[model samples]
Target chain A: MNLLLQLFLSFFQIGLFSIGGGYAAMPLIQAQTVEIHKWLTPLEFADLVTIAEMTPGPIAINSATFVGMRVAGISGVLVATFGNVLPSVIIMLIFAKLYERYSEQTLMKHVLEGVRPTVVAAIFTAGLSLLNLAVGSISALDLFALAVFVAAFLFANSKKITLSPITLLLFGALGGIGWEALGF
Target chain B: MSGKPAIDLKFYLKLFWTTFTLSLFTFGGGFVIVSLMRKKMVDQYGWINDEEMMDFITIAQSSPGPIAVNASLMVGYHLAGIPGALISTLGTILPPMIILTFVSIGYQAVAENTWIKAAFHGMRAVVAAIVLQVTWALFKSLAEKKNILPLVLFAAAFVALFVFKVNIMVVMVAMILLSVVLSIHETKKENMS
Candidate 1:
């Protein structure tokens, strides 16, 4: 299959199905791009995902562009990005008005309320898949990462201190820099 | 042009420029924006403060639509009105849009490199920790309500997806249907009494 076509179709599917946002899209995006297609290494994909999270726009959009660029080139990026965004853009443009009109209806309200928790579930799925991809085949580093995970988790859960993602990222980067400097 | 001068084209332009420039650098999505917006707007430009930025971020995430994009839009709109909103949105979107477009073009060849592979390995591990953190935060937020329904739904959904290998879409639809049935039944019960 043409690479551009593949990029387009894959990203289109990603955006169409993402439902909750970039976080929700992570698992499927990883499966399709990394596991099935081998378009990107798990790490490269992870890096791009981080960059996407850091940069503006949606994560799915950021991922689509990264994956698309990797596969096809500039034109490929355009196709893939368009594919990812097209679904949401078209849906918002077409349905926003209609949704607003009937948004107050009881059934619609209840249905959306039901779907909200599912969004969180979907996000959890994405987060776990990302964790698996990141911690692969390395016991010590994985354990260290796990320690950080437990620390961050307990800190947030028990202390309610909120170690924001940015804080963890800075600390992780500092750890990396420190390791590099130590030459261990 | 306005009498009060509290709101004007210059203020709108400044807001637009700030959002556009900040949007260019922020990738991934919500969390990155929190830091970057804090740095550029709060620290550098002094458009907002720590508390205001935090408030804006919380509001942006809770409201409908993409959090970063919405934040830019709301901030822009707040500063300058409709025009400010348009310019800010455009500014926020333009950088990543352009960079991603370029990157997508040559990403395949780039993905195959060796060092890229090694770096990504470490990066992925770090990202996993970050992701875990994201989930834990969400769970904590929801947990406080003591809503067993949501927790049950969460656990059930996880099992359906991981253990049963049931399709997520199918599970989502099932949950939605269940919620509707429950709502209707409750309404009917209330009416009968």
Candidate 2:
């Protein structure tokens, strides 16, 4: 198959398998782009991952766009993005019955109770991995990230000021720019 | 309270309308959608509740698609008929598809814009923060019960990803093994008791 076809097929499979949201799609996405298809270098994949996290849409959508752009330019972007989304569209349309039947199933409830923690663990792992990469082998910024993390943590628990995530993001970005300018 | 009348076309139309509009405003991800869906459907429309919503989330996650899409299908199927499911799913996804289409078209024009990039830089932190918050919430739910098996599996999965650099399939296999073993142990303990 052509690269475009492969990207489409692979991401379609991703869409088919990914449940919960785009974030749940990350492990498979990273594997396909970085390891399986070699569509992106690990560094590039990491960068793409960061970009996806930052973007407004779904992470799966963002990854599809990035990988598509990388592999086949604009055409690649369209194919992959569509491929990623198509499965959701098709499956939801066809298998709507499953959605109805399974929503109230007892087995599903138990399984989800089991899976929830694991999913949480996986996401936490993803966040930590991102932190590791963002700080590039862990120095003061690692600690700084941790402090910011704790602040967010405590604030969330205390129900204090509903600190806009946007504000924290601005501060982090300014800090990054300042450090770079200061040659840190 | 008097027993409410059974469903009607107007109810279906309202469900479809609410879900579609909700999709347009959902910026971050399904997390944002969760709260919004709760507010609109449960609080506003009295369609569902906290427990039912939790069930919706669980079912959506266990299924094979995006949670938003899955939720739409389920919610729509519940509200209306098969046609309702189709319409609701379409309504939920159509906006995002249209917006992304425009994004792909003009991607290059704005790709290098400084303000866009700066705003994105801010958004990244928000993503991380929100994801972390959700993860923490899940963690508390799981750990509160003190299920040693899942806790072990959680730690093992993390180590597998972080230390051994094992593949996700490997991690998944380990998780399955851990779950099966725990189930067997639980059975054995029950027999003993």
- Superposed model 2: Cα runs more than 4 Å off: A16-22, A38-57, A69-104, A138-159, A177-184, B1-17, B38-58, B79-83, B98-137, B173-193
lDDT of candidate 2 over A1-184, digit per residue (tens): 7888999998887786564465667766876787778887654554455554444546676677767765687788778867886776665555445545732354444444455555666777766655454433643455444554555556555565765544556565665445445553
Clashing pairs in 2: none
In model 1 chain A, the worst 10-residue window by lDDT is: A95-104
Model 1 DockQ vs. reference: 0.31
Taking the candidates one at a time, how many backbone clashes does each contain? 27, 0
Tens digits of per-residue lDDT, candidate 2, B76-188, equal 66556677677777677656555555554465467566655443443344445555676777678778986696687678777777677777655654554554565566557
Each model's DockQ score: 0.31, 0.33
TM-scores for the candidates: 0.68, 0.70
Candidate 2, residue B156: how far the Cα is off, in Å: 2.0
Poorest lDDT segment (10 consecutive residues) of candidate 1 chain B: B1-10
